[model samples]
Target: MSAEEIRRAAAERIEEAEDVRDELCAALHGAGVVLPSLRVEPAAYADERPRPLVELGRCNLRTARLIAEALRRGGAGA
Candidate 1:
């Protein structure tokens, strides 16, 4: 499938979830997109931060764009 198609599929999967990031990663993996190693961490200053923090070790630009588009389509902005 094309990258756009993969991205859309991933977004649809993510949208079905109550929590998105993990599901998104799984969907991408299922689509044969190898994501970089990463960790999700609670914001150090939760009172000051609006969202959780994620640390991505390394990712290709195309994969990053796909993830961003998926998040946007899923109503979860990246």
Candidate 2:
């Protein structure tokens, strides 16, 4: 998806959970909003494999920051 699309998706997911604040941070990281390491716990129950940030049905902070960078570089579609 496009960078803007990823950005918006990240924003939406961040808005969904207070605990996901760090996740939002990661998304921003993806957007080039640099910060220290973000701590994200697995949003899963016992006996289940933890899902990747992307598998959360949206882009995480890292992806968002990268997408933002891509957008700035005219590579958003990538």
Candidate 3:
């Protein structure tokens, strides 16, 4: 309705996105992998709906191998 309401809703969505990203980071940490560039995608805020996105950015080759190994070992858990 109001601009304030819209901003509040958008903030909530951003918080949810950050929460999801944090959860994923914790899971990856448990699996002995870390995504140094992991973060919420800033572009999502520019959208009409403001549905935030989690961005798993680039990592080093060693980190890539770690993720791959975790996935290969943990299957759905990774």
Per lDDT, the best of the predicted structures is: 3
- TM-score each candidate: 0.35, 0.25, 0.82
Evaluate all candidate structures by whole-model CA lDDT and list the values in order. 0.58, 0.52, 0.89
From the highest TM-score down, the ranking of the candidates is: 3, 1, 2
Q: Identify the superior model by lDDT, candidate 1 or candidate 3.
A: 3
Candidates in descending lDDT order: 3, 1, 2
- Model 3 residue runs over 4 Å out of place are 45-48, 76-78
Residue-wise C-alpha lDDT for candidate 1, range 1-78, written one tens digit per residue: 887776666555434432455775678776556577654543422323234444455888987887777656767553
**Candidate 1 Cα misplacement greater than 4 A, ranges:** 1-24, 27-33, 39-54, 76-78
- Which tens-of-lDDT digit does each residue in 16-75 have in candidate 2? 543575666666656666444444434522113333242233556776676667567756
**TM-score of predicted model 1?**
0.35
Instruction: State the lDDT of candidate 3 residue by residue for 1-78, as single tens digits.
Output: 888888888888988999999999999999989998899998877765697879999999999999998889889763
The root-mean-square deviation over C-alpha atoms between each candidate and the true structure, in angstroms, is 15.6, 14.9, 2.3
**Preferred candidate (lDDT higher): 1 or 2:** 1
In model 2, the Cα lDDT at residue 11 comes to 55
